[model samples]
Target: MTPTSSLKLTWSSALESGDRATDVQHKYLIEIINELAEAIETGKAGQSIRKILNLLKQYTDWHFCREELCMERRQCPAAAANKEAHKHFMRTFDAFAEEYKVSGGSEDIAMRMYKTLTDWLVMHIQKIDTNLASCPDNGCSR
Candidate 1:
């Protein structure tokens, strides 16, 4: 990977979830992903990558739970799909983290992880999570 490429995730209009809190959380997720990309691009070691992964995992869990609960309470139509998508992301992320741990995290795995993360979040936000916009409390106050 070319460290000079300046890989990063930028928030766009399409990412708007119409919910203040959720949108903020999504933005933070993008920030975390960008941080990981920067780390990889700069040739940071496995431990640093692991720390970012851990942070991602924790924040994702919290955000997903809040969002899911809000959707469910609001009787949003896309709640189930959102939860399922979140589960899929967790599994995929865990697998990536595990692979990096086993292989000591080469640039190849790092790039793959970075790509997978950015791709998944974009799709998830546009397709699934955005459905929450119609919910009574889109921001998932709880």
Candidate 2:
């Protein structure tokens, strides 16, 4: 789906690292976040929210593993910190998901989650993930 202004997230060149696979995954994550927002805004988020959250969690797990493997193999000095950051993100996301479940999918809660996801993603990609470009392979191709 095309990301609309209502999603409050727009991809920018600043988020790119010139790595095709990682860049594509990052963009997909953004789209998933936007999809979550759309589901909430459209009042289709009861069961759908759970599904979307699961999709996000699973994707996160896969992406982190893939990144960590590449980083470790390439001897990236930032690997440890990068893994920590990913773990922290997962923990934070889990907390939010639990809160949403407890609140019975409150709209306010959804918006809060949306904002958190959007902000965290943009910052993490720009600040943390960009460092992946410095790996021994120069693009984490290892």
Candidate 3:
């Protein structure tokens, strides 16, 4: 797909960190990202943006809970740091959502949301969630 296809936000196998649960969560994140992109492409940006934001909020919570559980199970030392990162993501997401709403849900706001989410997810998965996949139970390292 072209970079603008919205599929650009997809979670590729390359992004996998060897943890089945984490990979699945990342896939869900990609799905939501694509959904928002599709919504924008189809000119349903307003409704789709809201839906995507809500889905993101829910998914973020679920993903973090699972990551924390995995960390506790494996006694991963980075769990605290990961949780803190999740909190930061939540704060940023909330701020963006509020701004989008306050801006009257314009197309420009939708575009901004699309870019922000896609960029953030890509960076976050590569940097943060992937690390969790390296934990003992994740089969990435000793």
Write down the lDDT of every candidate, Cα atoms only.
0.83, 0.80, 0.74
Candidate ranking under lDDT, highest first, comes to 1, 2, 3
Task: Provide the RMSD of all predictions against the true structure, rounded to 1 decimal.
Answer: 3.3, 2.1, 3.3
User: Judged by lDDT, which candidate is best?
Assistant: 1
Best-to-worst TM-score order: 1, 2, 3
Clashes of 2: 0
Model 1 residue 35 distance off true place after TM-score fit, in angstroms: 0.4
Best by TM-score: 1
lDDT of 3: 0.74
Q: Candidate 3's error at 66, in angstroms?
A: 1.5
> Candidate 3 at residue 9, lDDT?
71
Better of 1 and 3 by TM-score: 1
Q: What is the TM-score of each predicted model, taking all chains together?
A: 0.90, 0.87, 0.83
Residue 138 shift from truth in candidate 2, angstroms: 6.6
